[model samples]
Target: MTTVPRRFEILLVAGFTESDETPPTSAHALRSAVVEATGETGESGYPRYAGNGMEADIDPATRTVEALLVDGAEIDYGLSVRVVAAPAT
Candidate 1:
C-alpha cells in the first residue's frame, strides 16, 4: 500500500512572567524565539506575529497565562508545540 501524507495544524502555547521593573514580552520577541528554535520562516524569511483578537486567560490561583492560537503563523518554556490532524474538507 502507498503511504499518504497527513496534514497537521500546529499550535503553540507558552508562559511568561514579568515584574515591576520588566515589561511584558512582545509578539515579535516571541515569534523570533520560535523561529530561532524551529527555523520556521515565512515569505519574508521571518515568521508572522499576530496579536489581533488575542485572548489570554490568567488564573490568579495558579498564576498561569493561557492563550489560544488564533491568527498568523508563529513563542517560550521554549514552546509547547502541539500538532493535530487537519480537518477534512
Candidate 2:
C-alpha cells in the first residue's frame, strides 16, 4: 500500500490565564504556538533570546507543547497546551 503524507498544524501557549490579558486573541496565541514549535533555539544569545519558549517542548503524537510564563516577578508560570491539526487546503 502507498503511504499517505499527513500535514498538521500545531499551537502551544503558556496558558489561557495570562494570554487572556494579552492584546492578542486565542487564535493568535495558537498561531504563535505553531511559530514557536517550528523555531530553533541555538546557544544562549541574541537569536535564541528572541525566539518563543513554548516551542522548546512540542509533542508530535499528542500535538502538545509546554512552556513557562514569567510574571512581573521572577516566578515562572507553566502552560500545558494541545494542538489540533488544521484542515488541508
User: How much does each candidate deviate from the true structure in C-alpha RMSD?
Assistant: 14.3, 9.3
For candidate 2, give the lDDT of residue 87. 44
Tell me the tens digit of each residue's lDDT in model 2 across 3-82: 21233334444555545554333476543422333344333211111133332333444443343222212223464344
The residue ranges of model 1 lying beyond 4 angstroms of the native Cα positions read: 1-4, 15-75
Candidate 1: global Cα-lDDT? 0.32
Candidate 1 per-residue lDDT over residues 1-88, each given as its tens digit: 6422222233343533344353333331332111111222334432322233232232223323343343422232456433333345
* lDDT scores of the candidates, listed in order: 0.32, 0.36
Using lDDT, give the best candidate's number: 2
Per-model TM-score versus the true fold: 0.27, 0.30
Runs off by more than 4 Å, candidate 2: 1-5, 16-30, 33-61, 64-77
